[model samples]
Target: MIAREWKCRVPEAHAEGFTAYLYETGVRDSSATPGFLGAQIFRRPLIGKIELTLVTYWKSLDSIKAFAGEDISRARLYPEDEVYELEPDVDVQHYEVIEHGFIPGGL
Candidate 1:
């Protein structure tokens, strides 16, 4: 499996709206792709903004290409992103999953 990670920042006030928009766009769109395994969203409170990270799991690079086009390194943005005043990373990072499991009795 592969993990594709992308990050962006938005105003604290826009956090809620941006999260919903992310689900309607990134999460929903990626879920429809063939090789999409799953996705996780993380948020951190910053001084005046909220940082959001989206990590999506995929079966393979080819599968990612199918969804992200040939240039998989580039971040995909939606037109509505401007509404939230998003500051998104221009590129994404991909890592091979060496290990992924839950520790017993640990949450």
Candidate 2:
């Protein structure tokens, strides 16, 4: 399994909008791709900014490349991202998942 993570900071005032955009774009799009296991979004407030981290699970690097294109290390960006992200990283980090478990909802 492959775990991909991207990090960024946005102003506190823009946090909600940025998060919504992330869900609308990354989460929605990734869910539609084959081999996309799932996605998680994390956030925390620091000073006057909000730090956002997006983690996505994939069955393999090839799956990620399908969604991310030829240069898989580069972070995917949308047109409106320029207004929300404050100094977002240009690249994403990928790791091999040793083990993972999740409980489905409706339990």
What would the TM-scores of all predictions be? Answer: 0.95, 0.91
The whole-model C-alpha lDDT of candidate 1 against the native structure comes to 0.96
lDDT of 2 at 49: 94
Q: Candidates' lDDT values, in order?
A: 0.96, 0.91
Cα lDDT tens digits, model 1, 27-94, are 99999999999999999999999999999999999989988889999988999999999999989999
Residue 45: error of model 2 in Å? 1.2
For candidate 2, write residues 6-100 as lDDT tens digits. Answer: 99999999999999999999889888889999988999989999999999999999999889999999998888897885668889999999988
Leading candidate by lDDT: 1
Q: List candidate 2 stretches off by more than 4 Å.
A: 102-107
